[model samples]
Target: MKALILVGGFGTRLRPLTLSVPKPLVDFANKPMILHQIEALKDVGVTEVVLAINYQPEVKASHSQISILQLRLCLLKKASFYFLQVMLNFLKEFETKLGIKITCSQETEPLGTAGPLALARDQLIDGSGDPFFVLNSDVISEYPFEELIQFHKSHGGEGTIMVTKVDEPSKYGVVVMEEETGKVERFVEKPKMFVGNKINAGIYLLNPSVLDRIQLRPTSIEKEVFPQIAADQRLFAMVLPGFWMDIGQPRDYITGLRLYLTSLRKKSPSKLSTGSHIVGNVLVHESAVIGEGCLLGPDVAIGPGCVVECGVRLSRCTVMRGVRIKKHACISNSIIGWHSTVGQWARVENMTILGEDVHVCDEIYSNGGVVLPHKEIKSSILKPEIVM
Candidate 1:
C-alpha cells in the first residue's frame, strides 16, 4: 500500500541541526532520519511513498535524489519523491536512472499534518479504495509495519494507531484502549494524568475517508481529526514489537543513533560495537581518527574527519564530522556536532549536546547542557541546563 509521510514541520524544537537541514535530513544512526522511516515502511510491503515537505525544499529534493540513486545502486529501489523539485535537474536524473516516476506538490503556506493529506489526497488514493499508512517523519520505530496493518484489517478498523508505552503520557496524545479487543475507547491530547501508559507513537494506518475530515486549512490531525474519530468509536490500537525512539530532542536523537547501532551489532558481530570493545559498534567514518590513550565507548560514533586526541575519554558520545577533541579532554553521554572543537582538558558530561562549531575552552565543564549550533563557549563553564 502507499504511505504518506509528514516532513514539513519547521522543527523549531530541534534547532541548529534543523537550521540548515530539514528535520528528516538530520543524521541518525549514520543515515538520514527519514530514511529509517522509509525503510520501515518498505519492510511492511509499502512500494510507494509520498513525502510532504515544506522547509528547505531544494535541499530536501537533492537529498531524496541522492537517496534514490543510492537505492538503485543497491537494488532497494521503490517509488519515492520529495514534495518539491518537480522542475529540478535531479528529478530528471531520478526519472531516467531509477525508472520510477515521482510527483511533487507545493504548500504555499504552513499546513499541519492532516492538511498535507488533504492537499495530496487525489495523488495518494488509488482506484482500489484502500487505506494508506501515514507517518510522522521525525518518529523512528523498528516496529513491524506489516503486523500493524494486519491488526487493522483483522479488526475491520477504520484507523489503526501504533501505540507504545511511555513513562509520561502527558507529553503525547494518550490513548485509552479496551484491553480485550484493542479498540480505542478515548483519545486524550496530552492529558494531565493517565490510568495507563500507552501513548500515540505517531504512526497510523488510516483509511482515505479520514482525509475528508481534514480541512483545507491548517489543522492538527492529532488534536482535531483523530479525537473526533475516536469519539465515533472507529479508531483501533496496535501494540508493536521492537525499539522506537523519537528524534525530536537532542537526547532522543542521540539515543536513536545508539539504538540503531546496537541493532546493527546484533545482526553482524563485525559491525561497530554496540559497545566500545567491539570494533563493529563504533562507527568511525573513513576520515576520522581516534587518538591514543582514549577510552572510546561501547557505543560511539566518530563522523568524517573527526579527531579524538590522546587521553580523551568518550563513551556513548557521537562526534560529528571534523570535530576535534584535544588531549586530556573527557566527554561522555554527549553529542558533539560537526567541526566543533573541544579544548584540551575540557570536561563535558551527563548528556551534554554540543552543536556545530562549538568551542569548549580548556577546563570548562558543561554537564547536561545543550549548546546550540555554531555558538561559542570560551573560558567559561555551563551547568546541567537546556542549552538552546
Candidate 2:
C-alpha cells in the first residue's frame, strides 16, 4: 500500500521551532515528528510514502495576479528552500534506514486538505484499486493502521475515516455514523450545538476512486469531498481505540508528549529510564549525561547529547538535543529547544519554551515564557508571554 502525509507549508502554529526546522523534522520524543507516522505506515506494509508539501511561488512586481498573502509567502523563499533541502536530506537518510521508498509531491499553488490528493494523483493511482492511507502531519497517536485498513476493506466504501471520541465536539469536526454499520451519516464542522462525541482523528483510508471527487485547487476535504462521499453512502468511519492528539501547537505538543510517554511505558517499559534519581516515567537518550543527585521523572524526555547537572529537577518536559541544565536548576511542563542552556539555580516551568541556542542566566526564573531562537534571558518572566 501507499500513503500520503499532508505536510502543509510553514507550520506557523509551531513557531520558533518551525522557524528553525520544518514541522515534519521537528523533534518529538527525540525523534522527528513525521518519523512516527512513517514508521507506523511502514509497519502496516506501506511501500511508498508521499509527503505533499506546498510550494511558494516567487514574487514578481509585474504580476498583478499575486495576492498580499502570496507576496508575504514569497518573503520566506530562502527559508523554504532551506527547509526543502533539509527535508530531502532527512528523507534520504530515513529511506535507507527504514527501507521504504519515500518521495515528495510539491504543490506550486496552495492546495487545501483534499486538493493534494488530486495533485499527487499519479503517485497514488497504480491501477491496483488498493486503498491508500492519508494522514495529517501534526497528529500523534498509537496508529492502528492495520486494523483501519481491515475495517475499510470490510465496509466496501470509497473512503474510511478514523474517528476518536473527544469531550468538546464543538471544537472539532464531529463524525456522526451508524454504530452498527459504521456508515457516516454526515459531518458537522465545529457545530455550535453538540452533535456527537466522536471527531475526525485526521487519518483516512481511501480508494483511488475517491481522488476523482477532489479538484486540483484550494479545496477542503472535510467541507467538500467527504460530504459528497457520505451522501453517496460510500464513506464510513472506524473508531480509534487509543490516545490521539494533534500536536501542532506548543501546549498540545507537551500534552501529547506526556500521553506518548505513558503509552510507551505500558508498551515497552524497558525503553524507559530507571534509577534512584528517576521519579516516574522518563526517557534519557544513550548519549545524554545525567549528573548525580538530579531528579527526573513523571514524563520527561531528554534528547541526545543533553547534560543534566547535579541537583537539577525536571518533570513533564522535553529537553531537546544538546541542551544543558546546570546544577540546581528546576524545569517542568516546558520544552527546552535544541542546544539551549539553563544556568545554575534557574527555575523554568509552566510551559516555558526556550528556542534553539537560548541561554537562561543563572538564578533566573521563567514561567510560561516563549523565548525565541538565539536569545539570552536575564530577567524573570512572571506570567505567560512571548519573548520574541
Assess each prediction's global lDDT (C-alpha) against the native: 0.72, 0.92
Mind giving the per-residue lDDT tens digits that candidate 1 earns over 239-328?
866667877887787787777677766665464633333333677677777777677775778887888888888777788778899999
Model 2: how far is 364 from its true place, Å?
0.8
Candidate 1: stretches off by over 4 Å: 54-106, 190-194, 265-269, 274-281, 359-364, 368-377, 384-388
* Candidate that scores best on lDDT: 2
Point to the candidate with the largest TM-score.
2
Q: For model 2, how does the per-residue alpha-carbon lDDT over 1-388 read when each residue is reduced to its tens digit?
A: 9999999889988877887899999999999999999999999999899999886777766558767877775778877888988998888998988999999898888788988999999999888889999999999999999899889989898999999998878888889999999999998889899878999889999999999888889998988999999999999999998899999998999889988988998899999999899998899999999999999988899999999999999999999999999999999999999999999999999988888999999999999999999999999999999999
Candidate 2 achieves a global lDDT of: 0.92
